[model samples]
Target chain A: MAIDWGFALRIAGFGLLLVFSILALLIVITRVVTRFASKKGPEEKEKKEERE
Target chain B: MIDYQTGFTGLTYGHIILICVGLIFIYLAITKKWEPYELLPIGVGLILANMPYTGLLLTPEQAGGVPGVAGLLGIFLEFGLYKYTVLPLLIFLGLGAMTDFGPLLASPKGFVLGAAAQMGIFVAFFGALALGFWGIADFGIKEAACIGIIGGADGPTTIFLTAKLAPELMGITAVAAYSYMAMVAIIQPPIVRALISEKERKIYMKPQLRAVSQREKIIFPIAVMLIVILLVPRAAPLVGMFMFGNLLRESGVVDRLSDTAQGALINTITIVLMLCIGASMSAELVMRPETLMVLGLGLVAFAAGTAGGVLLGKLVSRLSKEPFNPILGAAGVSAVPMAARVAQHIGQKANPRNFLLMHAMGPNVAGVIGSAVIAGVFLGILG
Candidate 1:
């Protein structure tokens, strides 16, 4: 009829995946933003100077 | 002759009430100028679907085709389109063509918010399961997954997956998903504010400085498709169709196909889909306590997704040196520009100078792909 134990384990496994993936997701997002923000720093200064 | 009196009963009253609701949607679409492109059609569709004894909405009259019974739309749904799984797939092609992955490519980090928002999907799954365990919702595994995706809040994606995977629940899922997307401009604002301090909401995100090259644009969807395919092949029908549509736009070789997909194809599918979905709402099927539960769960799912994105967003703000407005996080639910607009509106309330609409779109679009990937993952394991 039903594979109760298997189904429970799979749900449990997915829950863990969501948690670990979210942590990994935050790490990746932080790195990318910092990379882009740093890359554009000089250009931002140049624009500010031009405007002033 | 038609037995008009006998054919309609309890459903007649319920449908009349829903028609009034549709009228309100029509008012919102027209006078309020709210999401007119889709709301008007969906409103009329809701009315058409709810009307009882309207043969046009039934399943072809069981081959009797008696003069006064079960008009053409019903028969078509039973045999022609959904049963054959044609329209939903084609609709994905058009959606792909219309979508520009530029925002997503410009800020790959937005995928995290997209992923973050999907926490709503899984959370809603558990919520739906809880509802079932409570005997509040009559959902099993597949139906719960389909319903939970209302958190992803993209219409075609919701329709595509729900149609193929769980047709019976389509009416509730579509109504809840689209309605919530429309109301995101309303529901998400408060949640976003509470989660993010005004200072975080007021923070400005610098625009992506690099110009995305056309060559890269063309290559983008292909790369995404490859990764998604490796992860979840079952989602290929939707993902492949979406990427193919985007490819048509980016390829520069298929202007005609791209134009048709963006314009003619979307219009036709929109009409067919709305009507087909509406037709499924026969009174007995839709008025149950379970249907109400599905609707309630969908709202909770969308709100949870929005909150989850903002929470992660606040975390990102702290972790980064530059100020990142956590309001943009709520846009991670993928109502496209609508979710982003809410972010823009709320961000401006806190700081008039902040312009986060485009920034918000990065995660908004990413949420779309995230949900598709999640759908694929589920399909990979279950179906």
Candidate 2:
């Protein structure tokens, strides 16, 4: 069988793009959710309450 | 005059060599404590499969003519791997259940390191193609892809991908993946040291991570599952089960089920999966030029992965205002806590104040998800 170098390169290139894109999306979601829902650590809570 | 048949008479040099190899694996597992969970069972299976006149490798149909069959490892190979590919995915489920996503959630940037480490996969993919292009080995693109995934430093991912694309290469790839995983302590330090300077290794960030809420923990797996699977639906079997397992752990609602998935279920699947992988390595199948090339390429992939992670680690460190150790990038190859532990070990060696374990884990677990995503990509394109 004739090896298709073009297709092989495409799989390598596109596959990586897809992996990066998906994980990047996960990171974005994580950052957004944590910003909204993450519980402030004790240190942060104490300082914020003192300021209030 | 009736005579009883014996395996001793049928045994050849190939069987003897494989038996010796199996003995070596057993010795390493027992004495050195090297991946004993996987190596011990695989060693026993290797010995059993290579024994002449043993029907352990025979399919039920192949052994039907015989009055009775004792060695039935072949059944696992037929159904668990080739036909259904259930065992590896189940192992992923158990792994997910056991994993704590806190580190990853606490430090989202680890996700990028995890993705960067996967560069080794494509490196090996292209390397295999080049070798084949030159008529050096009989590797097609599918075979190259299987060989390439070993760089992911994930045993189950390698098994899952290989079984899907090229079952013939499954045993070799699995053994390579686990063996390299066991050698993470040995493999990663040199690559990390070479790439990272002593000053960078000494860089210390605060040990305390931002507290992730119970709500955030619960939302993570569900969110990841939906986003990843929607984009790469082919990953459903792996990512779906992995996220489901994590949900069982993080949800705080199904302790009993989660306990079973993490403990009993994973242990059972590991035994069956490792043994079948060992049984597949008959001498004729393993003793080849291509096998040697694949092994070499696997090492390259692993090293490349570590390099890729560290390079990205350097870049991320440069960009961030906080101090970050590039050595943590080495953990992005996804050998689990071992790779993370190696980062911590190397960091402390450089400076006692450095505590990179929690930070390293962010990339460590992300490597798992990243590899699975790549596996899905391979399956989507090639399968």
Q: Write the per-residue lDDT of candidate 1 for residues A1-52, one digit (tens) a residue.
A: 1223356347536743653364355345434444443334478789979999
Q: Model 1 reaches what TM-score against the true structure?
A: 0.85
| lDDT per residue as tens, model 2, B227-339 | 99999888898899999999999999999999999999999999999999999898878877888899999999999999999999999999988787888889999999899
- What TM-score describes the B chain of model 1? 0.91
- lDDT score of residue B19 within candidate 2: 90
Top candidate, metric lDDT: 2
> Model 1 segments beyond 4 Å from truth?
A1-52, B1-11, B64-70, B79-81, B207-209
- Candidate 2 residue B332 C-alpha distance from true site, Å: 0.5
Q: Which regions of candidate 2 deviate over 4 angstroms?
A: A42-52, B61-71
**Candidate 1, residues B1-383: lDDT per residue as tens digits?**
88555445636666777778678878988998776766777677778777665556656546476655656677656663456666667877897898876666666657777778877877777777766666666766777778888888877777766776788887768878878887888889888877777667778767553455566667767766775665567778778888899999999999999999999988887777766666666555676787888888889889999998998888877887767788878988988779988988898888888777778887887787777777766666656
